[model samples]
Target chain A: MTMRLVRTELVDSREILPGQWLQSFLAPELSSGSRAGQFVHARTGDLSGLVLRRPFSINTADPATGVITIHFRTIGRGTEWFTRLRPGDTVEMLGPLGRPFEVDPRSRHLLLIAGGLGMAGVRSLADEAINHGRQVTLLFGAASARDVYPSSLLPDEVEYVIATDDGSVGHKGFVTELVPDYEGWADQAFACGPAPMLAALARIAEGRRERLGVAKLGRKRGVGKPDVVGSTAARRKAFLQVSMEQNMGCAVGACLGCVIMGTNGVPQRVCREGPVFAAEEVAWESGW
Target chain B: MSPADLSVDLGRGLVLPNPILVASGTFGYGIEYGDVVEVDRLGGICCKGTTLQPRIGNITPRVTETPGGMLNSIGLQNPGVDAVVAKYAGTWAGWKTPVIVNVAGESVEDYVEVVQRLEGVSGVAGIELNISCPNVGRGGLQFAIDAGAAGEVTAAVRRATDLPLLVKLSPNVGDVRPIARAIADAGADALTAINTLSGIALAPSRRKPLLGNIYGGLSGPAIKPVALRIVYEVSQVVDIPVVAIGGVTELADVLDFLAVGAVAVQVGTAIFADPTLPVRLVDELTDECERRGIASYAELVGTALPPKPGAPSSKGVEYRP
Candidate 1:
């Protein structure tokens, strides 16, 4: 994909949660081509101290309005700098980077799960799925009700469900606990969250085919070969895909800073090969 | 007034078009930012560290940002020397900027082998020996810490290839003067001082180390002073031209390195924040030279070093504790 350096102006910024923010930028270049699960590396104004651009998942991209939103928590100075930005302020962004989620053409039902800020990763997919007339179900987990991503921010067609660890919201438990109810109905699943939660989802996804007694169904006559691991084709065929994270630098894959251990024992760049990957492609047991 | 000349000569017929260069690891093979940066405008591009074998690099969480800088444990992840030549050498051959292959290995033979493979290859202008990678388990920091090992490795590589060789110095050492002297004596064309300083960061949870590798090399504004100190000390001792690299963010930092005896500077960590910084610095340096009314940037080099001592301090022993 062709990545561009766009000068985006801050269109709006609001604290969506206690510490998290959902800010929108008017970047026509990004909104036109960026897909769900892709990300942007936004530069900070204060360059003296923070020498690295922060990587954020494209929470939503509205081509009609030329606006793309990024959701992030103020965990450090970079995010804090973003918080002080005014509406007219302009920032440089390099994106529509990394591989995006690959949906199967025949799939009619899409299940998306996110943990805390991970909502930012999968939020856009819901809109894209709904726009395509595919049924979308979103399962979100947070520390409590106060941290839950507001339903008003999501598309109206999405079937939203919530799980809170402290029992302050719907379905008092980890979001992974709710996957069993939807796994049989969903044709494909996508997730982004804490590694443990994603790992747990991966474990459940592995048993889904057997538990439901469903055979691998979509290969055409005489064209039934396994797609290579880590390829986009492989991800489209898998039952579960996940967006991954790592401390990053030079998000364009130049710096080997943002990498995760792949099942092939090679370190995959979270900023390049992913931000999204099929469940089986990743070596979840590798504690990296 | 005529424009100031920023050309730098590192001997053996190798000359940089200007004094600004993008450091090895930060720029990848130099094509990663093709759309964003004008790569041909820079003085030189030191491609990512090439090794004898394809390296997968470190585990996850390889990089993290600190207060004023960032720490990285990339562990010299590369596609091996053969693959590098086969993949990017053709592309680099078409660029105006000279591409220096930064070579690293677990042993002297490994370094020599990588350099040998790069020797006489089209598009490869020089070799920047990366003897200071601290993330690896062995042979990386070993050659850089001791003067003898440093000299031996340099000498071995020197005998292996005739390309202009630049050995990178590690700032993690106690004293850099002897090591710099040893590398120079081993017939290195020039010296690049200094590599990243070894450091560590803890995860937010504090349950384990932040980086997959327990230790990472810290780079950026935070290590500028330390890098300057090493460049100052090493430049005074070595006869070869010193190309400084540390926290070079702007033209001022480039001038600071030159004032401290560095003939040229390589922008490393700053490229992460702004990919076009090195090219901008080149323009800024020319403007700075014009403002100072200097015809060449060489006039600005080594303006801050202490006057050479006349006959080795006679009272040196009297001050010993």
Candidate 2:
């Protein structure tokens, strides 16, 4: 669905994890229309010195309550400002901005990988996949055990896996190490994380097509033209899709601040062409 | 209300249906607003800066919030002149409002080349030279800084295209009179002042600069005083119509610009906070004129300027310095 600006009221704000916050807003326009992978550009009170509105991924949207939750860390003044909002205060929001993840209907098994605070970008997709009756396995990576996303917040059906760099929690080393074991079983993979991790994931996904020997579906052994670069159908058929991040402005494709280099030799707008892109479409090693 | 009364003749026979034009960089080729804002209602649009070749722009964190304003160092991130005209000219050709292409470059040749390409384009109505880009680190000479370069580039581009030309003035310069005089002497039809004031913001941790580019252009209500001072200074120096752009948040700010000899005003950074402000200002301006019993907005122009010494004018002293 196309993006629209909506006004929402702060319903609840809580500290779900250390230095991380989860605030719920009662907004119907966003709750009913927002899909997995969509985000909201929220305007903070201008009473303080803050002038620009902040963008956040919709962590969870409850259609019944008309409430949507956003998860974020207090890394700067903008995020810190959000934590002080009262329950009844109103905020102007522009959303569900940007293109969303396109999940193939035929895919039964979905793998979601998130690193550190990147979980917010992929968290909603888990809710969506489970509601669509797809089997989901989530691999979350953090610096330590305390930084991990709480399992109680996730749907009971999702198979959750945790990895910590310090060996203070579930599995030691990076979360990408767990993907190979499930690579053969899963039909599609989606990830949101640090640039280094996303880059690593993109490389692994590029080789999976050859290693799995998975037959290219519905092509009839290559007949017609290739799927248009950066199209939704192209992203759905790809084995890996990533949600990219950048400092944003306008959040509606007006400001070209948030952009990623594309394989088509053009800078694709992350706010328009994607915050979600097929792995191959990105120039991962160009050091943008 | 008569729509005919709203029409304005901006010298050289160029007329506009209204006076509410979107400033460059903020509007993004005039299509970014989509359905949120009615482009047809706007009088004109100054698109983002276009150069001879594509610019990747500065690094990440291009924009940040400051006190009563915002700082940006976008560094003219455009898809080059040819790509820009090819991508949006057709869409603009279909719109009722005119798209004034704002061109910026490193040299005179760059400006001429870009303007030459836009000369016969269907959607392009005019040209606005961005002579005040202050974020670039090296070899980026601010055109509005010196009278000689400003006059040279303005004359060169004036010769390159028949499109109406408007040269933007930088506020960072010590004295704007010489530069404004040179640009007008070089054949510019109008002038826009002032671009953002040079400024920087500290990171929240207070350890470093907030913007990735370290320095950024300060824009918003915070810079209104500085912009007003420059507009007042440049408008008196040049006979060409002045198009004032600064922290125009309300009708009072608009009136203040007009009082200082600005024939028209372009609303910039303020749009991010209030997108409806420009349209509102249009209505407010009409009401203000009506309330004052003035037949046209022209009566409000230059009311604050001192009387010219040689020319017997009743207005306020031309600053001799």
DockQ of each: 0.73, 0.48
The TM-score values for the models, in the order shown, are: 0.94, 0.91
lDDT of 1 by residue, B90-188 (tens): 999998899999998878778889889999999999999998743244534578998988898899999999999999999888898999999999999
Residue lDDT tens for model 2, A95-183: 88878888988889999999988899999999999999999999999999999999998999999999999989999999999889999
Per TM-score, the best of the predicted structures is 1
| Highest lDDT against the true fold, candidate | 1
Worst 10 residues of 1 chain A by lDDT: A215-224
- Residue B12 of model 1, lDDT score: 74
For candidate 1, lDDT tens digit of each residue in A1-288? Answer: 488788999989999899899899999889989999999999999987888998999999999999999999999899999999999999999999999999999899999999999999999999899999999999999999999999998888899999999999899999999999999999999999999999999999999889998765455554576666668888888889999988889998899898888888888888888989988888988887
Q: What is residue A26's positional error in candidate 1, in angstroms?
A: 1.5
Off by over 4 Å in 1: A215-218, A221-226, B133-141, B307-321
